[model samples]
Target: MAETKTHRVTVAQRALLLSWAGVTDLGRRRETNQDAFLAEFPLFVVADGMGGHAGGEIASRSTVERLQAVVSAGDVNGPAIEKALEQAVGDIADHPETTDEGTGTTLTGVFFAITGDHAQWVALNIGDSRVYLLRDDRLVQVTTDHSVVQELITAGKLSPEEAEGHPYSNVITRAVGASELTAPDYVTIDVRAGDRFVICSDGLTKELTDYGIQHFLREHRDPGHSVDAMLAAALENGGRDNVTLIIVQVEDEDDSSSPIEDTTE
Candidate 1:
């Protein structure tokens, strides 16, 4: 039910422009993959599905597909983006194929654009899947998790360390298609030369430490290699959940050195 105007995205006047997505099946326990992802011009997403049976896959796939279609049709800005996300949620809630407790999905998406001398980016999400900005050697998480533990941390009811091992650590308060509609938090960032962006699912974050992520990004330098290192670290730790990752780099046209380009899924 999501609607939007059709618009074509033109190439940016930058030294590099590319997108990428990676996914792993449900780790050690589950027999099937429940996570879904997408990457294309101007858009990237990672969805973690939740529900019993195959409903998890349905929720994640539905959210990603609807979001991609709407963005492909040019839906944007806070209001349009919000509506499109709600519609995606509605689609999952209304899905006839869903056989389990109404399915839910964690969605995080990034939209990129270049206009004149400025490069713009938007990060939006409805659950714990995250978007991060890496500059110089510091890594900053741009999206907040909607989990109960995160809320407790925000409300000062629990310390960061205690919340990590809390009983409700995995309980998210909001997710796509879990309710009639869902609202996602949105943040716009000014992209600069030498900025690297990453969007990923909880699978990557659950196993790898933030320092581990920063170290890989700083040391590997290559987007593909960085993703590889992150995944390798996660698999080594246990690979307990479905993993998805997308890496993007921003550089000015004059940067003498070039970075490897990684295409999307």
Candidate 2:
């Protein structure tokens, strides 16, 4: 099931009406879902765990729980994120199963931040998971994947079309846990009206093309519907891996009301 919520935040006298939906599925082949997400106010994150057995699940769940605490503390910044990640690293290491299996997880998503003068979207990525933005009815990938295929593509060695069936497509260059932890690459985007952001794990990408993603987003106005539509398409397309995704829609307005939160299962 997808969990959906709405929030109205006021920052720098600016109002942003945000609605979002998130879901994680085991897919057709996976026995256990090693994906987790937190879709709370001021913060949204998706983590894709890697390793065998319960190691992956533990790594991902611990990471998101630590990050959720950071947001629950009432402030968010680079240092705070770093500290939270450090704590998450310790949590992952504490699990003997994870250490034995060399488990790890990919972290990615966006946070609602009030910078010095205005509101902005702070996107962060650590591995193959991705964050994309849809603005002006045009979709753009915001975070680059830290993977073997991505590195090859950037090096001009592997063409985008040829990289599709590459056996190394699943090999990520960075991760949170496993043997070590890596800092996330961060990006800031100025908030705008009618901006829609998609934070998803590579499982979704493995099944759907970019055009297919954009098409569904263009057809569905409600965040929950958008998430559901995409998830269904991914499963129908093979669902080769565990799938997890979040859709966040933002609208700008002056009539800022108190923060409102609601959930639908």
Candidate 3:
């Protein structure tokens, strides 16, 4: 047998081998984009702001900035992320403008890290914004909708179809800055190649069905284009609310090992 030379790729290249894109829209009726989110390292989020004036925009931006600052200042893990969200929510709630009487926002965040062969991601959500995963051409909702209809569905008082048309469908049961203390639901998932993540506000999901989303994702590879097409579809139906989307495609980090994670805080 002849001896052969092998090349080793650096860790930096492997760290960011994948690409992603995000988009937000004010819809046909809204005058401004009240949503804000982060796409920084190890943290990604989509927040839907609520208020009459610019309060929604302010609250959304504040939440993202606060979380980004906290994670940048120290370490960001499951517990740390939770604490950061709690503190941020408290601070935002303390604002006179973002109270139950006025402004608020719904936050949905995804934190992830890849090391060696293993990858771990966590989702923290407050409000009705959603996180979804597409695997094997199937679209599965990763986070539960935190709305009044969702509560009714869970309690067996309403069927899925009934909840869809419920008059209070948009009335969320939980949201950041709505109260002094808010608990965001956190979910963790292992990573694999060919897995796609979709984070969006209700506007996007409301007008499109799961099958519609799956078809669009399967048809479009560019995250940016996918979001635009989805937004257009929403408008075609009836752009009643704001629309926002974040799409991330995960591929094999290496041909060798599994994904990686640093749970160390």
Say which candidate scores most in TM-score.
2
lDDT of each: 0.73, 0.86, 0.73
Candidate 1 structure quality by residue, lDDT tens digits, 1-265: 1111122222243345343434454666557788988776577778899888778898888877776776778754566666766777666767776756557888887887444445578788888889988876679999999999998899999998897788998888888765647778888777555777788888888888788888888887667677777878887889988777877766545652333222211
Q: What is the full ranking by lDDT, best candidate first?
A: 2, 3, 1
As for lDDT, the candidate ahead, 1 or 2, is 2
Q: TM-score for model 3?
A: 0.83
Local error of candidate 2 at 97, Å? 1.6
**Model 3 off-target regions past 4 Å?**
1-16, 90-102, 113-118, 253-265
> What TM-score does candidate 2 reach?
0.92
- TM-scores of all predicted structures: 0.84, 0.92, 0.83
Query: What local lDDT score does residue 128 receive in model 1, on the 0 to 100 scale?
Result: 88
Candidate 2 residue-wise lDDT, 1-265, digit = tens: 4667899765445565789999889999999999999999878899999887798999999999989898889887778987888888888888877755458899999998765555678899999999989988789999999999999999999999989889998899899985786899999987776888999998999998889889999999889999999999999999999999999988657533333222221
For model 3, what is the error of residue 252's alpha carbon versus the real structure, in angstroms, after optimal superposition?
A: 2.1
The TM-score that candidate 1 achieves is: 0.84
Using lDDT as the yardstick, the better of models 1 and 3 is 3
Superposition-based RMSD of candidate 1 using all C-alpha atoms, in angstroms: 6.4
What's each prediction's clash count? 0, 0, 9
lDDT of 1 at 208: 85
Q: Which is the winner by TM-score between candidate 1 and candidate 2? A: 2
Error of 2 at 61 (Å): 0.4
